[model samples]
Target: MSASTHIAVVGLGYVGLPLAMALAEHYPTIGYDLNEKRIRALRQHQDHTQEVTAEQLKNSALELTNNCQDLVRANVYIMTVPTPVDSNHTPDLSPLLTASEAIGGLLKQGDVVIYESTVYPGATEGICADTLEQASGLKLNQDFYLGYSPERINPGDKVNTLQTIVKVVAGSTSETADFINGIYQKIIPAGTHIAPSIEVAEAAKAIENTQRDINIAFMNELSMMFHEMNIDVLDVIAAASTKWNFLPFKPGLVGGHCIGVDPYYLIHQSQQHGYFPQLITTARRLNENMSSYVSERILKLMALHSKHIVKSRILILGVTFKENCPDLRNTRVVEIKDQLERYHARVDICDPWADSTDLKQEYGIELTQNPRADSYDLVILAVAHDCFKEDAYTPQNFSREDGLVFDLKGLLPKNEVNARL
Candidate 1:
């Protein structure tokens, strides 16, 4: 917790970057990543992720590095690398393993290695510890300690930041847990909750997103059923809200790093333990299919309006996963575009928050930050980025007269929008 302690944060993305920046306020931090571009940008005080601003980066005491040898300067190592899935939706552990090996090379006696990425219950101890032991030639629990502090970073949220949100910390041992909790307590003004063990912290993190995914999946199913019955899902939800205890979860495309993918990690781990994760898997499937369903609904709405379907030029407003953010790792908005393309519709995407290269690399689709509003026959507001709602970005000079405007996430006025999901 002291400024004398040099900390190493591996994989400087959404979760790790913010954490490193926060820790840098009191500790000399090393922000390490394998990506040279990210390291270069960080050194230049230009974070493309936008989680940390240029001025904030300039003020930070965090040193950016790519080489594993550079991490030897720090004793407290925290891993925040990705835990993405394979094309088959299976948990891919390659990134985690590679990070563990990298950190292990710089391991010193009495150093603590903490994991912040979402994983199965025993992943921190089983996979990472084993890799560390093999790579560093250090015995577990004796030579070095392990800890888990699962990240709870909501991408677009400005209110619940690293300093404000309560951090959950746990460790391989009680002493380790206290040390880890003390470190996080320095920056986390909302305080910390020390779990019983590292596995409990892992389980706690996975369940947080899993619960949200299931709630949204139920709403998505209700949305589909209500659509068939010619009832607006939002309207029904509003009516249902008259009851005191009604949960007001809305229906939309479930995407991004946490909600769209974390449940699968739990499901895979559960299955590995000889138990099927029924409700969790069911919710994942239902939420995963929402993009295609949304695309079809758009087509049906076009047909209902007697608008041209195949050759019509469609403009998608936002491409990022969530509103007001730029992190586009596993956005499901691309799925809607894919489904629409199958119907022979020429869809032009525009997201002020997303980078064109990320959109192309992740989904094989091109996104224009400056879209020609005149050519769009239909404008589908997929993500409610703050720019889209502003008068300057609304493009009043364009086809507001001759096009159908479909607000999918209900970010705009109901009277102005033609339809909503």
Candidate 2:
């Protein structure tokens, strides 16, 4: 492994931004994104995503560029682009492939192309490696090298960061694997786990999220069952968690770049290999319909409160996928809103973390800048953003005195909520 390495991080979103900044400390790093606006904001030391702070951007030596030509100087390219699912819930690798093809065009004989995106096993060598070969006319492990270092970025989490999380590195060849390990070991203080092979690396990443999805799905199904029995699922979880072997997985909408989507990638690949993957596939379906379940439960609460669904005012606290993060890739909160709207209810979204512009653009959702006090007939705390958990922002302040207060995140007091899932 050479000390003088130029690393180019492709697709500077939540994962790419922090990784690029961290890599800059040890190597000459450049962060590239196709979005011109993102590059402009980053250059101004204003990270709209809030992944990187202003001071960090100001102090970091990472080069930010949207131009493909600027990546020509780099010998190591890391693909950090998203691998979201299509409308039909199929794995859409267009973003990953597009970034791969672009980086492939600039590949040199000894240059390495590392993928940090979450994908099914063998995607790097079987799909992306093929793309690199087609574009650059480079032979894998001979002319150019390939590495798989699946990203372990947890958005909105102050803990378990790039430096803290144990990184998994793998490559097409053993030598290339060691080189990739050395590159990541520079910044990852928690150290690295060198996987035996790239397929294992990819499978490791897929399982990381798929396992979470399965556990969460179990919790979600249990919540639904407990709800029908008129027993609070959280209370059940609390009692169960007293045991040493119990897994404390909470029930909620499973949507994001990883947990909600990554399992589908595994499911897709599993199906392609002639295995149905019944358990994982069932878990995905159950999790995907949680928004609908939550919405139906909210409407049931409204009916109990004598509030008519038609033309009713409903306020949703938090629009982003998760709390304290604005990276709304496949948030199911919008599905809840849409389901309510179908019944002619007027839904108002309020999230301090999400950008109003992004809300309107990405999902055609308009953020209620000023939610009227005690005006809504129903209030749903869809996302437990830290600010929403405060005393000042409680249900009594937003919903009508007798309005239904549905707490999906179990953040509000049991007495304060009409129902919690």
Candidate 3:
């Protein structure tokens, strides 16, 4: 079955690009994204995301395209579209639905449409299934089949990659499930686990991030409690990590495509079924307010140093959502900058990994490449990128004499920084 199968990975961003590259090693595969510029860049071995290197892109046989008609030849269509939240943090399924609607028109008998996008339970079986069926004029399970294999792609993570992570797959029918599992097995050396139903697979993906969000929320709560007691949260975390069975989750701004947004999908789905999850709701609220919390903490530190808030010079080191990555989706650092700016503080953000155009367009804030030494009233190390490592660079050098420096990620030398979260 694998030898004759042709694969088309739709929405080729971070997830689809890697998956298509891996699948191309074993099967005939083409990657399609709507962005023509991105397609042109990928074809020339230039990936702005930096998830895949120039050498890897240049060597891979994965065909890249922006035209939808190019996807009609593949028997397997994997949806790696982004499933983000709106301004209100509600699940935005427009990207998912639009991709599904497009793929449905090209569906043929015995074709399998597998979703790699993260969504709430029953989303693939209910919403996406209906969309495909309506557009294709075919009955699911009787004509075309559906599958769900949630993508486990970690942006900027090189160690636990696509082939290393275990894949969870499910299908509308038993034979379909087995077929999907086998196909993923060839690409994933860590192997695949076949779920009993599509809903179970979808729900598994939702909670994987929700669990991390709740755990990090607990850590954030601890950071707040320890702050009130005049204790450092990183010191406390270091001590607690010595235990045999402790889960080592640090406290900081939780943002990105998965942890920041996946929980809301489950929360929205649960509410539809008349079940309001208290723990999940509280965690989401607390994580969302971390920006305000960090902003207030910085202001308090500035006040203690006899510095006024208005027209104060501030430098924010690293603005990307996470360290060592250019992905800026739902970054909480912007919120921190906004909260501080409301008090008339001038905040200059510098991130080597992020694009200057994207940072300015997303937040209307310009990116500073080379910050002058000892020129700022205060400095905040928000993202722990490799360039700003304590061994490589000094964040204190950016702060003026007697100025305060706060290490949000606990990456700086403890003695150099005044406080840490």
Instruction: Give the poorly placed runs of model 2, Cα more than 4 Å off.
Output: 1-3
* Model 2 score (lDDT): 0.90
lDDT of 2 at 374: 89
Candidates sorted by TM-score, best first: 2, 3, 1
Whole-model lDDT values for every prediction:
0.87, 0.90, 0.91
Candidate 2 residues 95-125, lDDT tens each? 9898888888999889999999998998999
Scanning candidate 3 in windows of ten residues, the lowest lDDT window is: 389-398
- Per-residue lDDT of 10 in model 3: 96
Q: Candidate 1, residue 63: CA error in Å?
A: 1.4
Give the range of the ten consecutive residues with the poorest summed lDDT in model 1: 391-400
lDDT accuracy of residue 172 in candidate 3: 91
* Residue 201 C-alpha lDDT in model 2: 93
- Model 1, stretches more than 4 Å misplaced? 1-4, 242-244, 395-400
Candidate 1 residue-wise lDDT at 178: 93
| Residue pairs whose backbone atoms clash in candidate 3 | none
lDDT of 3 by residue, 129-235 (tens): 99999999988988888899999989999998999999999999998999899889999999899999999999999999999999999999999999999998888
| TM-score per candidate, chains pooled | 0.95, 0.98, 0.98
